[model samples]
Target: MSKEFEIAREFEVDATPEQVWDAVTSGTGGWLWPMEAPEPRVGGKGPFGSEVTAWEPPHRYTNRVEDVEGISEQTLNQLDYTIEPRDEGRRAWVRYVHSGIFVDDWDNQYDAAGRHTDFYLHTLRQYLTRFAGRPVTAFATFEGPEASSAAGAFTAVARALGLADDTAEGARVRAEGPEGKPLDAVVDYRDPYFIGLRTDDALIRFFGRGHWGHPVGVSVHDFAPGADAAADEAAWKGWLNGVFSQP
Candidate 1:
């Protein structure tokens, strides 16, 4: 049997394939995924210094990757992105396939691939959804002696969600802790906030500080016309709960 494994993930974004393609081709766009950078042209730089093997505009892009940094001889790998139009907007599918020898175990590689796929798709969805019609925004609040730490945490979270470098407008942190302080940070579409710190540990603390108001508030536009705030909240809560449930 071939020692190759493949992992794929799909996401629905409220934008046209061209828009999604633009995001995928943008400098900040590639950062949302595992690839270091993506050059649109064939034979151009791809993930991990690989070369683009295929380029089909607004639809599919494929690259040939290699492992040229060790005892392992150069091997061939492939990463592909396919976009399809959907009723709401566009559906994007990213597929990764690896072939060749494996010194250790392939299980870890598979696990990592799965994680990366999930994170990338989630980030893409979040970015395209938030920036679908309006400019991107970053909302943050800080507390405790580690205000910078909190701000850093928020930034890290934003980044993981596909926000770019200039998206943030610095930290609007408060002087006191959660109980006695309030802070806010907002960023535009051209400059989106990308979270860079450890946020999983401070989830409850962050929410308790009343900073979830804007970030978690889903727009009514995402739902049907008759949908109310309660329904929106419930849907968002479910989505968030599902995300947190992931290992």
Candidate 2:
């Protein structure tokens, strides 16, 4: 039998409860790869056809998948979000929980899920603080090869992006992304596991999952209108493969 796994988080953001609601329910396609949403009320259809288990505007939302798609093993997945207003509605506190069953490869699945939660939540905070109400025009995910799991992988990635050694929060970075995508950005968030950059029209996130025995990953959230997501994805894929495949 598969055991239940739950990841919980409590954090505050500069956004109001309603805004947080949009970020959760309406979808954060900007930071997250897929831009999908559920209906405002209970029983609304989700993007992946999951049933909306609970819904309360700007407050609580929960969706459950009876059996996770694409996974051969049986697994029940549910994500719950609870929001509360703070500071006369100027800011808000969010309580998030992602619970599911790991029918196979429990350790690796749990680790990837947990790390994703941390970085995704951090990206949410960045969106709220820096780019609230700015719709995502394009989004892409970049992945390195299995060899990227080797030691010092992120160092090479970061250097290629033109970031300085020991680049801390608030540091300036000027780099060219896939297809010469200009990134005149600032380091908005930085940790051993992840680093986030905010350009005028995008939020770029780098995941140092290689340090945790996984390949490196990157997410690009473009706010510019008419941005080509498919092209960007292809470009980034090629670039990451090159970066990781080199001697």
Task: Give the alpha-carbon lDDT of every model.
Answer: 0.43, 0.82
Q: Which lDDT tens digits does candidate 2 get at residues 1-247?
A: 5778999999998899988888777675865667467866688777675778898887888988866886645688888989999999999999999998888668877888897898889888888887889888888886789987888898877877777778888888787676566678898877777778888988888888876688889888989889988876787788777787777
For residue 185, model 2's alpha carbon misses the true position, in angstroms, by: 1.2
Candidate number of the best TM-score: 2
lDDT of 1 by residue, 1-247 (tens): 1256667565566677777776666544222422355776898887666788878887777777566454355344676777777765545443333334334556755654565455445445555644443322222222322232333334433333344554443333221212222223222121222222111111111221113212321122221234344543454345433333334
Off by over 4 Å in 1: 29-37, 68-71, 88-103, 132-247
Measured against the true structure, the TM-scores of the candidates, in listed sequence, are 0.48, 0.88
In terms of lDDT, the poorest run of 10 residues in model 1 is 196-205
